[model samples]
Target: MQQIYLDNASTTFPKPQAVADAVYQYITHAGTNISRGTCATTTEDLVFATREQLCRFFGGEDSKNVVFTKNITESLNIIIKGLLHSGDHVLVTAMEHNAVMRPLQQIGTELTTDNAPTDAITFSRIPCDADGALRLDALPQLVRPNTKAIIMTHASNVCGTLQPLAAIGSFCQKHNLKFIVDSAQSAGVVPINMQEMHIDALAFTGHKGLLAPQGIGGFVLLESMIDEITPLIVGGTGSLSHTEHPPRFMPDKFEAGTLNLPGIAGLHASLSWLQQQGIDKIRTHELTLTQQFLDGLQQSEAQNLLRIVGKRNCRERIGVVSISTDITDIAELAFILADRYAIATRVGLHCAPNAHKTLETYPTGTLRFSFGWHNTAEEVNIALQALKEVLAHGL
Candidate 1:
């Protein structure tokens, strides 16, 4: 059976040929550890070139401000752990993944803005509408005297609802609060400009929308935030070998130890591919596929059996569509789709239990079918037919 993979939100598959070729070329021909070897020209040049590519891709003003890590989780850790002090207050949406919530829980007292929080280190969860759109009007009331930053995901990984970043950035500007975005779901599919969005920092993964391999992700920070954020990981940066302490430079301050050259090479190539295709084109393709799937669900008889988790309109979301059903075990349904129908999907909280709770699907997760740039309308139709069959089977 021909398999249909629809889990792009987790990680994009069938990466561009150039991306795989770049990774293979690095691993086979130029496998030197950057900043450590005596002959580091090739490795250093490739790494820096990848950095430049990412800088332009994210609309970062300075190339040196791009700091790479293992993934978006690590990037968020670096930002949250490095920037938040003992008494700093934070604002986050109800749709945050564990990447943002776990770190904040570790260092700050997280609370919901609907209720009053104590004067100690505090963080508030902003509410979202039934359609998963954030209640931006509540932001002004949510702000406290000690609120230091607003950390939010650009789009919900569970339901794919696109947040109003520009308006939130304006709110942050007015409140004199830092705007830190987690772009794991929107980096490549959505256009993000740091300067235009007034973003202080952005954390992103290369594996998902960027269409690169895993094990490589990074953050973009403005020049002003360089001094404010402390280094989470401190070690040799190849620049200050003589010094015992970690370097205080832009990228070096956050990036420590050996870099993921192979993964970076893949990302470099993927950036080139994205540049050639243009982000708008890729976004339109994905959105069109999403609309096709949504329309199919609405028209199909299985529509009564499945309830879409977020906004019905495709324009309000990315390519992620999560559906919850009256069936008790959605995981079993997912297994039947995979084992019998050869249709792959993600079924669970999607690492965002908070989002599921906000959507009122807690304790039971949705069957998420996320699309990609390469996914076709025909695949969506096949999945829809498969879903109808599953429902006919009394599931």
Candidate 2:
């Protein structure tokens, strides 16, 4: 059977040919590390070029402001831990992943220090509407005097609901609150202008919309945030060699040890490819596939057996679509889809239990089908047929 992969929200698969080639070339030919050695010209050149490419891709002014990490979870951890101190309250949306929630939970319990605020840290969740869209109007009422920032996801990984970043960013700017966005689901698939959107920080993963391999993700922050935010890890940065402490620089201050050269190389190639293809074009293609899938679902005989999560409109979302069924065993359905039809999907809370709670899908989660640049309308029809058959078979 032909395999149909629809888990782009988890991680994109079948990355661009150039991405795989770049990784292969880097591993086979260049075996040196960046920032640690002076003689590795190829590695150094690639590193610099990758940074420049990322800066341009994300609309960041300074290349130094882009710091690499293991993944978006690590990036979010670094930001949440480093930026929030005692007495600093943060406002996050109900759609935040475990990446954001867990770190904030751990930090809120800690005591204050001299350099930090005297009071303990606090977090408030801005609620979402019935359609999983963020309620921006509720933001003003939730803001506290101690609120230091508003951290949120640009798009829901579970439901594909696009948050109003510009509106939220404007609100943050008006209130003097820092705006940190988790672009794990939106980056490379959506247009993000840091300066125009008033975004202070953005966390993104490489394996998703960026089309790079896993284990590479990072964030782009305004240069001004460097001094205020603390570093998550401290070690050799290959800069200020004489000093015991990590160098107080843009990326070196945050990045430590050997970087992911292979992943970066892959990312560099994917960025180049994405740049050539254009993000808007990629988005349009994915949205087209999404609509095809939605239309198939609506046209299917199993329509009564399934419930599509979020809004019916594709313009308000990316390519992600979550579905619930009258059948209680959603995982079993996913298994059948996989084992019988070779349709791979993600079924569960999707690492955002809070988001499930907001959607009232807690305890029992929804089945998610996320589209990508490579998915075609025919594949979506096949998936719909599979779902119809599964429903006909019954649990």
What is candidate 2's lDDT per residue for 350-389, written digit by digit as tens?
Answer: 9999888888888798999999999988899889888987
For candidate 1, lDDT tens digit of each residue in 221-297? 98888998988889888888888988888788888888888999999999999999999999999999998888878
Error of 1 at 62 (Å): 0.4
Model 1, residue 54: distance off in Å is 1.3
Instruction: Show model 1 residue runs off by greater than 4 Å.
Output: 112-119, 300-303
**Whole-model lDDT, model 2:** 0.88
Native-referenced Cα lDDT, model 1: 0.89
